[model samples]
Target: AERYKAANQRAVQLLEKCGTTQVEVDASGLLTYPIEKVDAGDQPDKKLKPLSVDEERFMRAFYEANVQEVCSAFEFPHKILATALQYFKRFYLQWLTCVYAACKIEENHVSAEEIGKGIKQDHHVILKYEMAVLQA
Candidate 1:
């Protein structure tokens, strides 16, 4: 519940900065953010709506199903899939914290693609560090 509140706050911050949460996809599959002048005094708390119980449940189910689909699509071994899923769960647990911290430090609205790329980069760094530790 606390994490959900933090995540909601982070999303509100992003929406307030970007004007809308929806991103435009171009013909080349590139995302373009819409720019609107939001009043500095605009209250995010009032503008952002919290997810209802049913919506939250649906989202959770959808995410789990998608994760399973991705694992199956790649024909990943059960052990490998389990490890990946664990990492994803752990990542999500910290996602709101990381995003909130990043927003404070950067003072910019981070896009979903940017967050995805950052996670992928972090995975690569972890793998490299693990390889180094194994070699030592």
Candidate 2:
């Protein structure tokens, strides 16, 4: 319950500025969806995939660590950290790469590179495992 509240708050804060609905950047560094057109279903449609048990566990671990790193780097409140982490986990439950993409979309310009630098985590590893995480 507490985790949900935290996650909800962070998600709300992000949407307050970034707008509701999903937006993403493609591999070519082009933003695929515009916020103004979000309500119009201008974004590409993709099928929702279910996660395997192993994938769930890995995402849980990944989200927890990523949350700690992001909160520590930005000096955000514990609640915010908890919220962001929760958001990441929940998102990945439905979509794999969505967590990192959400972090970038919702938060203030969080890039994969910045995340790696802040957390001392390898960006290459994160990118490499993105597909595996999705498949898991």
Candidate 3:
């Protein structure tokens, strides 16, 4: 709950500072650039509304179900699926932290996919280091 509040607050701060959270997407629906700032006159007032408690709960449940669905679809081992879900949770926390920090420093924003790529790189680095240690 506190984490959610912090995340939301950070988002609010970014939106206020930049006037918008608009990220450009290419024809393939992939983010091609950093977040773009909207003119003050063009910004929408309700763009950064926080979700209600019910909405938050629904979204959490939806994500959990989706994780399970993806695991089932791929026939992933239970242990691997559990690890993936744990990583998913941590990834969002790190992502929100990064977004807030970046916005403060550079007024830049990143798409979720970009954040995921970064997290994936970190995951690979950690795994490689761990394997090296085991082999030593």
Question: Which predicted model would earn the best lDDT?
Answer: 2
lDDT of 2 by residue, 83-121 (tens): 556655554532223445445435545566766676576
Q: How well does candidate 3 score on lDDT at residue 42?
A: 65
Per residue, candidate 1 scores C-alpha lDDT tens digits across 1-136 of 7776677677667665655444443434355668555543576554655465457657766655655654455354555445445544544322222332233234444443443454453432222222222222
Give stretches of model 3 more than 4 Å off.
21-31, 39-41, 45-54, 93-136
For model 1, the superposed segments whose C-alpha errors exceed 4 Å read 1-46, 93-136
In candidate 3, how many Å is residue 36 off? 3.6
Scored against the true structure, residue 75 in model 1 reaches a CA lDDT of: 55
Q: Tell me, what's the RMSD of every candidate?
A: 13.2, 12.5, 12.9
Better of 1 and 2 by lDDT: 2
Worst 10 residues of 3 by lDDT: 127-136
Q: Which sequence of candidate numbers ranks them by lDDT, best first?
A: 2, 3, 1
Off by over 4 Å in 2: 1-66, 76-83, 91-99, 128-136
TM-score for each model: 0.36, 0.35, 0.46
